[model samples]
Target chain A: MGEFPTVTDVARVAGVSRQTVSNVMNTPGIVKADTRARVEAAISALGYRPHASARRLRTRRSSTIGIRLDPMIDGISGSVLDRFLHALTEQADARGLRVLLFTATSPEDEISQFRRLNDGADVDGFVLTSTTADDPRTEWLLEQGIAFVTFGRPWRSDDFTAPRHPWVDVDGYSGLHAATRAQQDAGATRIAYIGWPSPSGTGDDRRRGWHDAMLERGDVSAEDLACLEVVTADGVDQGAAAMQQLARTAGGIDAVLCASDALALGAMIANPARVPVTGYDNTPIAAAIGLSSVDQPVDEVAAAALELLAGEFEGKSGAPSDPAPPPFRMVTPRLITRQFAAIPRDSVPVNALVSEVSR
Target chain B: MGEFPTVTDVARVAGVSRQTVSNVMNTPGIVKADTRARVEAAISALGYRPHASARRLRTRRSSTIGIRLDPMIDGISGSVLDRFLHALTEQADARGLRVLLFTATSPEDEISQFRRLNDGADVDGFVLTSTTADDPRTEWLLEQGIAFVTFGRPWRSDDFTAPRHPWVDVDGYSGLHAATRAQQDAGATRIAYIGWPSPSGTGDDRRRGWHDAMLERGDVSAEDLACLEVVTADGVDQGAAAMQQLARTAGGIDAVLCASDALALGAMIANPARVPVTGYDNTPIAAAIGLSSVDQPVDEVAAAALELLAGEFEGKSGAPSDPAPPPFRMVTPRLITRQFAAIPRDSVPVNALVSEVSR
Candidate 1:
């Protein structure tokens, strides 16, 4: 193997001391312009690159962000994470940071990886996704005094005024609320909702959006509301079954809103009433099928996560940190309305009512 | 921040010299069993982890694999890369290797990233994906004498008996051939194919599979072959348009096979004749919509790539290597047959002809 060019070689070629070369590479602003240019030219000519590990050892920072690549399960919804990861990688690259990917089978396994990475000082911080209520990962990271940010809120309590760590999450409730109101504005008298079973933080939040919208109408009684809402497991087939049950129980359904695109698709397929349906996550399939869906601003979420991490690292760099509120961003999602095309509308009676609604 | 435990602290706790501690960490087999256990216990108690950067510098090897995370376009087909990444991460982790992701806008940009990563010795090797004919990235890596494996063939020539570098690619020709034969077995007298425009190595290779199968049938004339083949850009809408064009130009397309699920879905939606359709890539949407498609064994591709890289690295470590042929694995893809359900079959006459054939 050929030997790689060293800093000494670059310094000799540039007619400068080794320290000047180091200054040119690490703190170019501190070096004279002419000397820095000369050093850079020599570096380019010799194809010299400073060892990342050696530099990291000196700075006590890896300039790398770590994230877990969860196993691919639901390809429909899993594309959300894929998009976010791409955005994060692009944003991190712009900020001179790299993303290191690791895999863990369980939360416990993830924590062990965190410890291993933390002990080695292999990464500056971590960006976590797929947060659940009272997430053990967050708790462990906080206790370890690790610098990290999550793409989801802690969901520990109803009051989201403060969190123990930094986080950024999309507002599912607001998204569904907008979807329901849009359906109401479209001259739909009866709108049914299909969602995941209770105890899910995200699902419950979205369901409340539809519930509140229905209550504001003042025409539907509590008994009617109960009849209009269907809670089932999150899947395409489960969604189809829920729609069937809703059609049998809830009279004359004019519209349906789902917690996810998977369920929304199922509802569209099984819709005998041919109601206009809205889904969450605005997935590729939703776009292909022309389903009106809620779109999470994943790029904004990634940017916010990085911003919080930057603030944390800046505070650790001996800056005079303010007694600020725990950092958090509740990004409102946008409703992407497309022409409903899952079923042929000419054969259904409700099509006349929904046709005039601007999509 | 609290001070992290160092080799000195571990050595003191284990009642050993710093050199002994280092030896224990680096080469446990060289240390006495009792001494190794004592050092390990001390490390566990102190929560000491050997510095990854320091170890890397000593060994001149970073146990990290670099890959460019291309921007997410065509979410339907893009899921293939997502799945491959997850599988690679899992397999690399099992081998004590890390996967580092970077974004590149073009081949030139990707090559620059390779240089940057290589200069720092930050990654041991790279795994290239999304190969095109005469890919400059592979050329640059080869010129630099870097250890790398590609998840795609070089595609520089028609004769793929040997290549410049180790690679593992799915056999697109076989996949399409099997898909065509499956349709024939299902009583499809006239089968049509929809694929991307030519000059795309992967696309053309897949097209050939269908072409060879039809040619072997002896029943399809050259003029009929031209009529049955539709070439266009890859998109759902494009697929739909292609299928329409086929229905107009080609008579009675009893079954259709697409180069991608996105195209197959389009053909299915636009099929007024209600023919069974198959897509490639066996994406989650295919399963959701019950579109039979070809499935790539990404897990196997990842394993093969890593195994090739290991062989390359082993050859570099003063081991006598065999004069073996350049490593390559043309993995055969599986034709996943699912019940076609994009359109209802009760009204279509073609359904009667296809119903007797097993799925």
Candidate 2:
């Protein structure tokens, strides 16, 4: 690469003094329009992009926040991530906070990467997504004394006694309830619940909501319902197998509620075309297929995350919680249904059709 | 966030001097295992993530790279972005460089974002994705003398003239020609090409390749074997509509080639159960469904992008390129055929389909 144009070069190209270039940058309106245009043209012509972090260090305020994602989570559907990323982008834009993206190949890499960025002063604070039950990142952030907030809920005891970190999560329990209610409203009495492992906080809540909704209806009992724990690799094929297994059980299930759209897609490929399914995370694919799903307010989650991060940055430590806890704040999920789950009563029943989930 | 424990705090908690904590951080092996464990426990308890940027600035050798994605470009699916991102993550991990993500909401915002990061010493160089015709961001980088590389062909005449700016792009024409020949080899005489807008360099090349291949095979007259352009949107519905329009005019073509898996998906959904179609960009769905596609070596693209950026940073200015026109390096695309495109000639007569297209 050739030598980058220095400020003097910009002045030369713009045919203006260096002071004028500075004025055009920091106080553009103050400069004459013609002069401003010239400077801008020169800037564009020269490919003059400024270095942000160095300027931030000098100014002591970057207005940029660093975000970390787990590589394992990257393999998930693009549509779901698009929603979350969109939300984050919209909120960050409004707040004038730039996002710094970092990916950790493994859990251990998390600490080293965080250290690199933190020491560099490349960001003001941190925003973390997709945390596991026993998260080390949270604990590490707490020790570093960095101002940070997470997308998922934290598992800590005696909240006040533990290091306080703010977080915002979708109310998965309520979302599941809404999904089940939508299916039941569509005339589904024998409903089946397909969920993820309990280690995932949101997944656990969804499973609970499904059972609670079913019990409240009193149309089906624990023995009548089937729960499928989905594994990660080959999710679609495994989902198809689980659907077939659920169908073989004594009274056939009418509607199925899936924890994720990926699982829902799998179930759709797995289920007999006649058997309808419900899904959570109204991902783009779910919309494309017209699958009924619970649409968690991704925009709301992103807004709340930014607000929490801003609050922490503003020196507002953990907020007051209900009497049962020291720190507390929660957001709820919304339900959205489409053609797939809105089956008519006159439609052929599962047993009358293929009598099994198609592999 | 509370006050983070300094080196002193770790030392105090571990019953050692402050230098001991510092030593434990720099060289864990130097410290006794028990002492190191105590320091580690203290570090974990205190959340002590190191700030690498701060040290790097002082050392003048920070291992970080800047990334700028326009929200518009990033939002587009089937654009080779997912593969690029994945490649960036893997290569960056191997090279020990962290990515600092930033968004340029508009062309004007590009300058400030670049200056803010670069001047602050946030990164050593940058990888730019999805530049439009006559891009201002590219121009500004050229003027400022920053180090950067793009993933697509540049619109400006003087782009390659700028020593510090470089680019790497897919060899679309070759890939499209290969797909066309593959279709011919499958015993299909009536082949139709469905592609996106030709303003995209890749799309233009693919279109050209299709024309050339059809000419060589004499499958259809020059006027009959024309390439149809389709607009990109949310789902395959639009793709289905476009394909239906082409199918109606072309007397139900036998084999079709698509620009992306998303488009191919739309085509599949349009017919639902039967259709012989091939797509470019072997995305995950292509593999899952076993649809034939051209796989642009994403890992190679990202590695090349990084290498281009590194060259610029090292002041080499121009990346290696073909001396001939087109002014950019072209990486070849590999063909991957799956079950969807594996239709046997016996299933559908080639002469009949050709007669339909000729009409």
Candidate 3:
């Protein structure tokens, strides 16, 4: 036949009804083994491929996940999302699911997209990224009883034990704490912290890591700790400027810990020979320049997000209706330390040694 | 009323047949204006959503584009695809299309995925990346008469004027040519060219740019031009090694031009103060380290690929059956010039100046 084969064609070829043909394709367990075998043979012989949309409409389930593809803001840190997306796609594909991408300008637009995709039955669930404080997207999703898992914590409250929705986040506090401790172990007495301004959940969490690490040292007084901390906007230039100021006022900073690779890079640029700097996110720039940084296990985060979405929290406490704490995974990060003769300034020397430790 | 509103419910509410309701939803242009308006109102009042799969099955168009999400191999150059995917998602969204992502182990697996998506009526077309010589994917797509566009040229032939399929690619030759000219104009007479090994389409094209630029200068002999060039596998370490070998063997290298930012960065790291280098792709590393490089206009490429897939080549002299050179777009890249006191090799001091120019 010149026309494409349809369900009816498969039914006639298999000597079965149209519903039987569909049942063989969608709900094979409901059909008898002999009849299913005949239908399968007919489907293969005639190359009768069932339309995904038609099957989805009948079953009211599309093996597809929806996600909002954010614009590339900065290649440095923006690469985290890129890596996460790649990992998510691979994981979803392994589960025989497709990842559908849409673009939205804002949280409201994203929620609207969710409604469109959910209403159209185009997606079974969603994976959200870049979670912010009191994220309206999560609020809307929770209100709608939609299935979704974020790659970041809800950040609605400081208590990580409780959240309204499932989430997977990198433990920034642990990452920075380890970085600070690593520097301290390397014999750095006065280490300076450069990070984004307060009222930011991620930045503050990372800053606290450095703060607690210094406090545990017992040698640096609380006043000295306060002086060692420098707040600035996140950027290489801002990091450089912060390092410069801290060096002048903090009385010779032996090491520097940053909230982001951009800031760490700046600090390294400002004083290549004076201090060993560690940055967060372990971006490519850090590896290229031989700067130590905290590496977020995004692949683990992706896997955990998929598990949460798959409702793999059966062994955990609380029922579906109970006010139980939603399942969330906090993946520990690894600190990558590189000891080079100097930070990449106008080339002066050589010798590079790299090491990694998970916290 | 408690259950989802289907065609039967919508038809009953609107006082129309089920087919009429479908026509209103799927082919509104064919329905009477008054009847279509009435059905739409009933749909809105009842919150009746026409299932996307049902409509797709009826119309045989899903308005979806399939793209394979490559695993993130290296954050540096891999970011180009990341940026392209983001732009493509945004551009496709602006046209009321969705992007579906899948992962495959190899080209054969990718083709099977294409068949699955195409036969299942889950996608209208595809957007392929990483085009290679005699790509079997393109061959299969051509044989299947699929509507798809590649982001790179069909390298089956060097004469880009005639390709079996439509494509959008950056003019790497022009990008390197402009970069070479820029370095020469900056008063650098003895420039060294660093690139990947030959038999590679993109690498060869870029090398020709530098080669032709040197030939045009009329000062460097053919023998000297050959001596000035060094080829190696693409990487930062490889680049540094190549640069060192070139510097020692070629004698007194004033400037360096690399096929990629990774190589350029490597060269800069090896000789921070000795050579000013330019790299291709203008990765974030280039900016962080203050290295000059060429920037691909990926946004334009995304738009052009979508246009080609949408059949925007109506003005071109090619009938459906005619072999009148399937339309293609070769976008010219821009050169970003960044001058700093030194590379980040245990930095001593810096005075940075950044500028950009289109070629």
Candidate 4:
């Protein structure tokens, strides 16, 4: 936080030549103990600290943490992983660290990359994202005693297995819970949920948020099970089709909440009758289209993750000696309400929409 | 290309043990000249290349390239930059090189960061994005004899300077030229262009695309100049507002084109009639809403940039002895058509849209 202690400062305080200070700092064993002691005392008295980079040099570490960029990008509109990488790099820089970006075809291949990079001393640790059920990479990293933190909730193929690694995730359950409760407060009676099919912890947790909120309202109906819940693949098309199906089957759905902005965007596009719609992940598209959505504090999540993985968790957790899981962080999410506009019209044919309309 | 030639293969061809081949390769001068010549002959005979990493270590280069991530991100819905980064990482990995991600507060600050990282031998070269007029960083890089290639066309602020470095940019001029011609082909005589106000090469290049196509149609009128071109600051709101302005000034505008999907999305949102709208950077939002956009083959740009910067350009163009600017590549762009549908009404109130109603 203050000016870095220079060799000149040390020499001035210790009444020694700058070379002696440099010798004491870089090769302390070569210096006479008393002279080295005097220089060290002067450094402490002046409240001067050496450069962090120099301290890391003594450890023979690269002072760089590696992050793997998945070869496949899911949605261009929701580059949550990219945003996390951005924040992590900035936070790492502030700590005199750098980010090493690598790519791997799969989780197993990622383990190999970790081995290769570590063997070459190219990276000291890693940051993981989009962890899935029974993640093989987690297992491999744990076996190798590699240092890392996941930006997703840990899943072990079963709920009984407690997480064994450090992780930081957006609290989607609470985010959607509040979103649904807000709709209720705003006089929505029959709320429907549109989300991905289950078995994924993230999807299930978000759907639970809506279910619990509707239950709290005592507006839960048996029809909610068969008629309301629409579980489909992820995308605006799936979401729109799901909403259309829900409208055809069940009559009185008033408010809709989606697991993603993609779903909400789709729902908004196909909304036959005007309906209040909310989406998760307040992506730029959601904002552009004026859809209420949950905003994950991506920067905070990255900072917390770097602090836990690269700063503190490295020394304490995810170590082979301690086979227990590290404490996890659940970053709170916020809601942005812009209220989607109704586009109440049948879609025109793609070809006819753009034609020789005389100028 | 071929199976990486092993020491065994070289030794077998040289009629020597693998250990002798290894020693000859590592410490050739220490080995007898006759034996070294034999090993060298065998290496050539087998098309054997020494480990690139070991060669890099001997040269004291990190075999890593730097890419600067601006502290602020523009849009989540169309992270063209993020996509470009993803492709670059994959391509770099293929070349036994890694990418170092850094952040900077300004273009000038990026120059300092480049110096800092390079001084540490952490990176051997750089890939610059978003190059703008009178880019101080580019000037600094050239003056310092740093190795780099930009992913954007260079500009000297005066508009007379040819880009003075190796670069790979999508042919936005051609992409938009074709897009405007498509509209012209479709019978829309009066077309409007919405883009950023500029001395920027990208903005200017795209504007020229539209202007040129319109010129091909006939002599462009003064009224056409005033009403058909709208340039403003970036954002959906600004774009929406700009399109509204154009609509008010010029009637019978049948088609619109934008420099970015954000602007096109805005223009679509505020559409007073069913006008064919197009956007650039075929982002996910463009696909979701079916907005026709120009697709910049990002993967191709990344590959071409790395090919020029890290591959051939490194050895041939950026040598300290030769200070001339390297060659640049312009990958062709493609147009994707997905006509946007008309919403057909003013937005309903957020509350009114949520109220319970009988079907």
Highest TM-score: give the candidate number: 1
Residue pairs clashing in model 1 are none
lDDT of each: 0.80, 0.63, 0.78, 0.74
TM-score each candidate: 0.83, 0.76, 0.83, 0.79
Q: lDDT tens digits, residues A284-357, model 2?
A: 44554456677767778888888877877666223212233213356787776554433222221222221211
DockQ of every model listed? Answer: 0.18, 0.12, 0.20, 0.14
**Residue A286 miss distance in model 4 (angstroms):** 0.6
Clashing pairs in 4: none
Question: Is model 1 an incorrect, acceptable, medium or high docking prediction?
Answer: incorrect
Tell me which of candidates 2 and 4 scores higher on DockQ. 4
Q: Indicate whether candidate 1 or candidate 4 has the larger lDDT.
A: 1
Whose DockQ is greatest here? 3
DockQ of 2: 0.12
Interface RMSD of each: 15.3, 15.3, 14.6, 14.6
TM-score of chain A of 1: 0.81
DockQ of 3: 0.20
Predict model 1's lDDT versus the native. Answer: 0.80
In terms of docking quality, how is candidate 3 classified?
incorrect
Q: Give stretches of model 2 more than 4 Å off.
A: A1-62, A72-79, A156-163, A226-234, A316-328, A341-359, B1-62, B72-79, B155-164, B227-235, B288-290, B316-328, B341-359
Residue A191 error for model 1, in Å?
Answer: 1.9
> What does candidate 4's lDDT look like per residue over B31-51, in tens digits?
776787798777656545445
* RMSD, every candidate, angstroms: 10.6, 10.6, 10.4, 12.5
